[model samples]
Structure formats: C-alpha cells, structure tokens
Target: MKLRKKVDKVLGTALAIIMGVMVINVLWQVFTRFAMDTPSSFTDELARYLMIWVGVLGAAYISGKRLHVAIDLLPSRLNKKGQTKLKVVINWIIIVFCLAALVIGGLRLVYITFTLKQSSPALQIPLAVVYAIIPISGILMIYYKLSDIINKQL
Candidate 1:
C-alpha cells in the first residue's frame, strides 16, 4: 500500500489547494461586485470550473480510500466469505460503469469539445481542458479498484 499512501497524500494536497483557490476566487468575486461595483468576470467561472474538478477528483480520492458512501444492505447481512465475494462483484460492476460512463464517454465529450474549438467565455480556456478530469479521475478510480482487488486488501 505504499503507492496508495503516496496517491492519498498527493490527491489530498491537491484537493486542499484547489479548495483554497476556489474560496479565494469566490471572495474576490464578492469583493469586486460589492466594493468595486462591478463583478470580476472570470472569478465566477473559475470557481465553477474548480468546483467541478474538486468534486470529481474528490470522488476518485474517496473511492481509492474506500470511503465513499454506500448503503451496504446486502453485504451487511452476509458472512465473511459472502461479503468478500459480494465486494468483488460490486467492484467489478463499478469498474465496468466507470469504464463505460466516465472513461469512454468523457473522452468522447472532450474530443468533441476540442474538435469544435469550444472555449469558456470568461476564462477563454478550452472546454476540453475542463472536461479532461473526467477521464483522468476515471482512470484513477480504475487503478484504485484494481489494486484493491489484486492486493485482497478490501
């Protein structure tokens, strides 16, 4: 789990930094609107995009940590062997979902946006850049789940 530790450290630090920036950006937006009597055009958009990254990346981090919320109704009632088998099944289902919905679909979206030359209005950054995290997080999730299964650490 050494690699897991490293990933956790990096992801936690990145999330903290992004959250700080998002807070600052919102504060600046508020300040500019109230004090300067004009809204800062980019802060709102930047915050929005940062939030998207934070949310998705946070999800991936939690998945790696096995901390994401789950009801566990059936697993809770099962014995150890049954629970382990169920967990493996659940993990496989999640892997397939992430592969299809997040990885493939996200890549398609990013490609389309890039091909269309779409850009955010306020930041003027390419839309593809913003959408890129989807597949990245998807890959990270796949890695984590595979590692967990291989190590039998769950």
Candidate 2:
C-alpha cells in the first residue's frame, strides 16, 4: 500500500510536469507561428513526444486509481465475494494484456528504433526515447494490477 502510494505520487508528479512542459511548448509554438510570424522548429515535435508520454503514463496512473472506464453492471450484480473474484480475474487479464502487447511489442519497437537510429526530423531526438513510455507504462500497469489482486480491489 505504501509502495503504491509512493509510485502514484511519483508517476502523478511526472505526468503533471510533462503536461506542463507540453502546454508551454504548444503555447510557444502558437505564439511564434502567429504572433512572431515564425514557427519554432522543435516545439511541435517536442509537444508530440510529450503527449505520447502523458497519454501512456496517464493510462497507468488511471489504472492505479482503478479509474479506468468500465461497465459496472456485472460487478454490481454480483455479491461481495463474487465481485472480488471477478475483479481478480479482470486484473489478471489486464496484466497479461499489458505484458504481451505493451511490454513485449513496445520493447520490439523500441529496439528497432534504437537499432536503426531512427529520430524525429525536427527534434532530432531518438524515437527509442519517445517509445520508452510504452514499456514503462506497461510495467506500471502490471504492478497496479498485481496490487489490485493482492488487495482484493480493482
């Protein structure tokens, strides 16, 4: 429980910081394009990358909070024990999906990008770095799912 709280705090702080930077970057982009009559070359790419981080990390954060959208009908219909069993099964499903799709697939993608030395044109930042959030978020989600199972909550 304490670990989960700490992880939540760190992840939340990171996402907030990324969002702030993205907002500032986009604002600068808009100001430069229209107000200054010149666009900032790197701001667009930076914002895009930041958005990827936010979206992926945000998903993990939401999972930790058990705030992911879900139909409550089934669980609501069940008794307390049934609901808990269902939640455990669902958490296991989520863990498996994240492990297979996000962790494995994302790692493949990151490996390919790093191997190829792929980078964004404008930002010149490695795509591997940008794609790192996929596996990171996957790991976080797995942790949350496991925690949910151990705690008998979703």
Top lDDT prediction, candidate number? 1
Which stretches of model 1 miss by more than 4 angstroms?
A: none
Candidate 2 — what's its lDDT? 0.93
Index of the highest-TM-score prediction: 1
Regions of candidate 2 where Cα sits further than 4 Å from its true position: none
lDDT of 1 at 58: 99
TM-score of each predicted structure versus truth? 0.97, 0.97
Q: Which ten residues in a row are the worst by lDDT in model 1?
A: 145-154
lDDT of 1 by residue, 1-154 (tens): 8988998899999999999999999999999999999999899899999999999999999999999999889989999999999999888899999999999999999999999999999899999999999999998899899998999977
What's the lDDT for all of these models? Answer: 0.95, 0.93
